[model samples]
Target: MDDLEKAETVLQALKTAEQQPPQAALPILNGLAGLVQGDPDAPLEVQEVRADVFMAICELGKALHRGQPAEALWAPALTAAKRWRGLLG
Candidate 1:
């Protein structure tokens, strides 16, 4: 799948993973990070999105790793995902 599709997939996975153990989410977070870091040929707008999403994922991952409740992870990541979706329209 394309990168955008991959991101959406990762986001969906993250959403589905709520209330589960943090360890279960780490690999998915890694996948999201790889998408952000893997693209060097993206245009400026896409790169900006990648950066924002990357930051969101990083924060979410850290919180999860620290044993924070899953509810703490949703809002910021959802906001970032929404912004990324807006970029396509």
Candidate 2:
């Protein structure tokens, strides 16, 4: 898919992540990362938010593996995801 489509998919995945278990959300985030693959052509704001989203995903994964509560990650993850969605407009 194209970058915009990929971004939309990432947004959807992020939304889904909010409701899903950590086990399920991890793969969803991974899939969104793979879908976009860090589109170099995107604007600086989009790139920044994308980086934040990816970082949040990585942190979420690490937390899950470390037995930390997933709740702690959702706020930042959702914030970044919302920023990303706003950038798309």
Q: Against the true structure, whose lDDT is highest?
A: 2
Clashing residue pairs in candidate 2 (N, C-alpha, C atoms within 3 angstroms):
none
TM-score each candidate.
Answer: 0.72, 0.78
Model 1 lDDT tens row, 5-62: 7567656766765545678876677677665563678677877876887888888788
Which pairs clash in the backbone of model 1? none
Q: On residues 1-89, what C-alpha lDDT tens digit does candidate 2 reach at each position?
A: 66667667777777887697777776776676675466798888888888888888788777866768878787897787777767776
Candidate 1: misplaced stretches above 4 Å?
Answer: none
Estimate candidate 1's RMSD in Å: 2.3
Measured with C-alpha atoms, the lDDT of residue 50 in candidate 2 is 83
Candidate 1, residue 46: Cα displacement in angstroms equals 1.6
